[model samples]
Target: MNDVPVAVAAMPSAEGTAVARAAAVVGGPPAVRCTGLARRFGRRWAFSRVDLEVAAGARLLIMGANGSGKTTLLKVISTLIPPSLGAVQIFGHDAGADPAAARARLHLLSHSAGLYEDLSGADNLLVLSRLLGRPLVDPVALLARVGLAPRPEPVRTYSAGMRKRLQLAALLLKDPPLTLLDEPFAALDPAGCGAVEALISGLSGTVIVASHQVGRAARLCDHALLMHEGAARWQGPAARAVEAYTALHGIDNADGGG
Candidate 1:
């Protein structure tokens, strides 16, 4: 089996670490705030009347079954789509009124890798950096940080795990303060999963992960939100959220271990 290379023990830079420490000490507005948030496609409500608040430097786990609106909630918070009702704020900036500001402060890793299939992995990062109006940082270093070697081959030939690694590199390049990850553990091997978990553990900014890998993800998070039928069923300690999820679903083992 060809496993993707992952720098499992990679550490953030001194500047990154300082920024995280400062944010924690300053104690400013919540990193993410949503009031009566809702989204709809025609007549079907993807999610409705959801209220959420995540403090700075907190890790939040969003758990739900398929079609439970986990992806939709992340999208709205990321400013990729507008909420049909209510409002969203990122770092105290109203997402609807100031989308650019909100977007500048957050990074969203969705189901799609969002890479240019025809471009090399390095080139993809460079292009994205340019498009986002960020400085031209070293793509090779970014790729290396994510345990992906610089390759001349276009992303079209890369494996699913490789693409995911490249996406991670992109996330590093942006280095946004608020990160929204949707199913980050999917399409990854044990090593890749471990690498992702490590990366999340090191993030100093606010993180919200939507995942089904309950056992591993919950432990890494300080808070958890459980979604059921397009609504938030529970929100509190990560362990209790896991218990509520398992009890509601009647599962003996949610993800094998907590």
Candidate 2:
């Protein structure tokens, strides 16, 4: 792990410290910049010609119908997959030219829990800490912070909401400069949703969330982008997200699942 390029050294051991560290870099180049970003799978384009800029410390909400390319856009920004056309810059670092630098400053919490089902929640954090070349500071406290209780049972026994909470705990441990979340509000109870909202509110760095829970997500975000058929249909203040989405589709209820 000593050779790992991830910036785990001197990483914040607590959420408060992480917030403070993120605040120190609040103003600079845009946290994320996409120029003509597009992704294609065989014959169909998942998303195309998507150009956007997210400022540091901004919370952006991405709303669109199912298969409208919200997840694909996030994957490209996270550098998990390359764009068929276009470039992505994370805090001024080109993702294509220098992916490692971009990755070190961001964390992507995708739809999958990305956890080891055979490992306990605490053990999962331990492994991640070692992989990032950091010491396991306090998994118990971290789990609690995400509204998860310490358990001896492996992650395979955890519920969907519990798994989401654990994934959030892992994100806090990294405390990257940019955070990308895909359907973060899915599979959570009211309490779990509240916990997620609180955590997002506390983050001082850039945050991008792709979710179908338009009403709730819009409130937490400062900026909004609506995608339709592989293109950006609208981009503006979060307050008008529902209106923009409604006007495009003529659907009064944008709260439906994606």
Please provide, for model 1 over 178-249, each residue's C-alpha lDDT reduced to its tens digit, 9 standing for 90 to 100.
889998888888888888877776665778899877777776666778887888877766657668788878
Q: Candidate 1, which segments miss by more than 4 Å at Cα?
A: 1-27, 256-258
Location of the lowest summed lDDT over 10 successive residues in candidate 2: 1-10
Query: RMSD in angstroms, candidate 2?
Result: 8.2
lDDT of each: 0.79, 0.82
> What are the TM-scores, per candidate, against the unseen true structure?
0.88, 0.88
RMSD of each: 8.6, 8.2
Query: What is the Cα-based lDDT of residue 258 in candidate 1?
Result: 30
Residues 10-59, model 2: lDDT tens digits: 22222122243333243578788888788999999999888787777667
